[model samples]
Target: MPRRSEAKSGAGSAVRFFVYRSPMKKPNTSPAKATGRCALEWIRPEIRALRAYHVPEGQDLVKLDAMENPYPWPEGLVEKWLDTLRESAINRYPEPSPEALKGLLRKTMRIPDGMGVLLGNGSDELIQLIAMSMQGSRRDKPRVILAPEPTFVMYRLIAMACGLEFVGAPLRAADFSLDGGTVLDAIEKHQPAVVFLAYPNNPTGNLFDTELLLAILAQAPGLVVIDEAYTPFAQTSRMEWLRDWPNLIILRTLSKLGFAGLRLGFAVGHPEWMEEMNKLRLPYNINTLTQASLSLALDHFSVFEEQITRIRQDREKLFRALSAREGVTAWPSRANFILFRPAGKSADAIHAGLREQGVLIKNLHGNHPLLENCLRVTVGTPEENQAFLEALGIVGVK
Candidate 1:
């Protein structure tokens, strides 16, 4: 007994329902309209042109690409660490200022009294913090970040992220070493707001000349950040230079000290610079668990020291083994890793062949002009090192 209009409307409802029920049906559309949108549309254009940092996947394999310590903490020490963490109040927020961790770090690191320590999730975060603090109020001047190529990629990545200009000077080709004159020239030309020099440069695995570093630090117009992530292996640090150059900041981490899982890195510098960086740092940036675990681990430094010593010894053995082999040129390294070039054969072939054999190492063939046909290997346990050496023998450079 429905009226004709009601019947028509019911039919329309049924049609709509049918359309909804049909998975293949497309929505009806009106003419495309350019409506109100964010004024920051240009941000997308900028981002699209930027290359993101690619972290390698090596968790399942031998897991050596990241230069992490290949050993775990002593079982007893680990248990004690866990017991210490048992009382942590994870339900509540951690202290905004991790004073205890800082104190422990100062004591453990033997940090100078006037210097301040800033903790980072990793040294990467500290790099970002340095960039943020230096960039400050100037979007127009185009803050400059100066670093040598074939070094840490984060310096350039972070600079690009902050919309700052990055100037990468190539390392000396013969040895992949820092060229002080060239670096000083770049500093003079660019007037960079920040300069980063990775002590014991990555991928090349050689420490920069100390005298040259001091000269560059003296000449640099802006802050000089010396990333000493591999200091444990080298057993040398510029920490004492804090008083000599207020513009100097030294970065260190537990990653190479057998606690990559904890993700603890610290930057040591004058308190004034640290104060500015602290202001921009997120409250409770480091979680309670990490701080507690790192504190416990620091208390037992001998355990970590023994592991590092073993790695250094293993590194020497690996270097000697590679050097004796034909068709591969091994570079000297102060780090727990080695960088070598395949003399007659393509590094790619060796890398792929090793991977096929269940061995993994970084193939740095085309990354840079200096790194052509280069492969970097982390120093592993005696057994692991022997395995890698045997794999190399099978692949045999040429």
Candidate 2:
């Protein structure tokens, strides 16, 4: 496709130029329209086949689908935060390096000494940066990204978006723990450029075994990323592992810590790796508002930490409730969400029934073979949790 731009010469005469990029076939249709034949010619079939990541509409619903913190700031804290935002300079671009925020995050997250920080709009962006940094990034022989099946969807989505092949090493069928044998075998065969292990992985909500993870680090031939997005609930971290493994990087996000609106996530690792990934990060990628809000929020970290403690307690209670229910097989979780399966009911039917009763949660049927009949609900306020439990009982659960 050709992009038109105007430039000025030394004499100030206007100059027009057309830049043509490859991978796009010229279309017979004119540039006036962007659909129909034009889209067919320019869009990759791989992209066309992919479904855009969708967030289900939850207007007027109880809303527990996404793994997000359910509580808001206290009224007094809200006022103080508003003041911070009001004083922030939105007119100027944010610090591209975000040195102060990095220092604060290091203290808050307890990242090991000597590791550097690389910030992202969210962990999703950092994941993309890692994928883009792989050798032959823009498709010479398509680099490969490997991860255990039924983990976070972004690793696969970002890999394909960067013109790389994604390989899923199957997880243990009974539980969603890492299948060590299969993973090691796949790593040897694929020689993936990036291997992602989501600690307390998504959808299944179980932490992979530490011993198996270390084994993977030993066997993997390329970069190894530990995605600890749920560390706020799990209360364990692999930060110390970075001191030992040169190829290791740990990814975290404030989204799970009652600050999802800020859109801040970061990577902690050896300086050599962060220096390379930093090159692909867009200039001023994080806006001033986010930087200001996160700084203020971190100072009031105890407020969120208290909320996390309550959520952790409630998560156990909710787990017990699901486990005691006759038809539900609830898996224990170290994340804010619980994964369960219905014994004698259709997962879709149960999900739809809950929505009709003004409750919204994830329905994981058919997403992967291991996730069949599974649904995930985030731990909410006590009242909301009761609403979900009663709603589940009203649905097909015995």
Candidate 3:
């Protein structure tokens, strides 16, 4: 692609010049003349076969689908945060490896000594980093990425996007629990380069067994990433395990802690792994505004801590309420949300009714066999929870 511009040396005279030009090669526009010719033919077959992950529009609804904390900073803290941001230098680039932010994260996240931290815009980017780094030198035996089915979808998506094989071991359908024997068998068979386990697994709202995790960790031949995105709600962490397991990495994010807008996530692991992942990170991925905002927010961590406590309490209340409903079976949750299956009604129709009543939530009716009729709702404030419950009642969901 090239651009043509005109420059006038004098008042009347006009001159034409190629002011701008693209240095890289442009896409091939020639017609293939095949049985069915198209631009998609240029794309890799694996990429062309992928379906994008979709997020529904939550423009005017109560917006309880994304598992976001539905709270804002206190009045006094908001003013202080604005003041802190006023001091940030937008004209200058941020430090490539933000030492100060890393220090705060280490202290705030309780990372153990000798462990290293690498930041990402979010856990999604960190997953991309890990996938990219695992593209082994040998192509004969392509690298494999493994995880339990019905967990976080990104683990498999990223692997496929990176042209690596993905193997998903199915979780027990009875209660969505990890089957140790099956997972171990898959591990032995696949020899994956990376394995992801989402603690307090999403859409299921229960943690995997600690003993099973340890057994898998010991038997695995490669890195095991324990995604703790909801650690704030769970009130427990595996940060200390980095010192014990060289192949383990703990991935966390502040999105669930009321900072989803800032999109900050960190990976704590052995320096050897961190150093390599750091190499794949783009320069200054953490912007000035995010760094400034996070620093200010950490100064008032107690506010967020209080909010987490309230959410946990609200979660218990919501769980009890849902369980008491005539035809709803709610699963126990340690995270800030609950997953339930509708006993007699269609999950899809109920989800639509909630939307029509100005409440939005995730409907997992057909996502997986284990989640046949499941719906997840984030624990919101007391009023929001009441509104959701009332909407449920209005829909005649006994």
The candidate that wins on lDDT is 2
Highest TM-score model number: 2
Q: Rank the candidates by lDDT, best first.
A: 2, 3, 1
TM per candidate: 0.87, 0.91, 0.90
lDDT at residue 335 of model 1 (Cα atoms): 96
Cα lDDT of model 1 by residue, 66-175, tens digit: 68788887889978988989999999898788888889889988898889899898888999999988774334577899999888878888888887888999999988
lDDT of 2 at 360: 100
- Give the C-alpha miss distance for residue 286 in model 1, angstroms: 0.7
Candidate 1: residue 233 Cα off by (Å): 0.7
Task: Return whichever of 1 and 3 wins on TM-score.
Answer: 3
Flag regions of model 1 displaced more than 4 Å.
1-46, 136-140
Per-residue lDDT of 132 in model 2:
91
- TM-score for candidate 2, please give it: 0.91
Clash pairs, model 3 backbone:
327-398
Q: In order, what is each prediction's RMSD in angstroms?
A: 8.0, 8.3, 8.6
Residue range 1-398, candidate 3, lDDT tens digits: 67788888877889887866559876766565542465356667888787899899999889899999999889998898889889999999987888898999888888898898999999999999999999863458779999998988888889999988999999998788999999999999988899999997987888899999999899899999999999888887877888889999999999999999999999999999999999999999999999999988887788999999999999999999999999888989989889998888889999999999999999988887888989999999999999999999999885
Local lDDT at 36 for model 3? 42
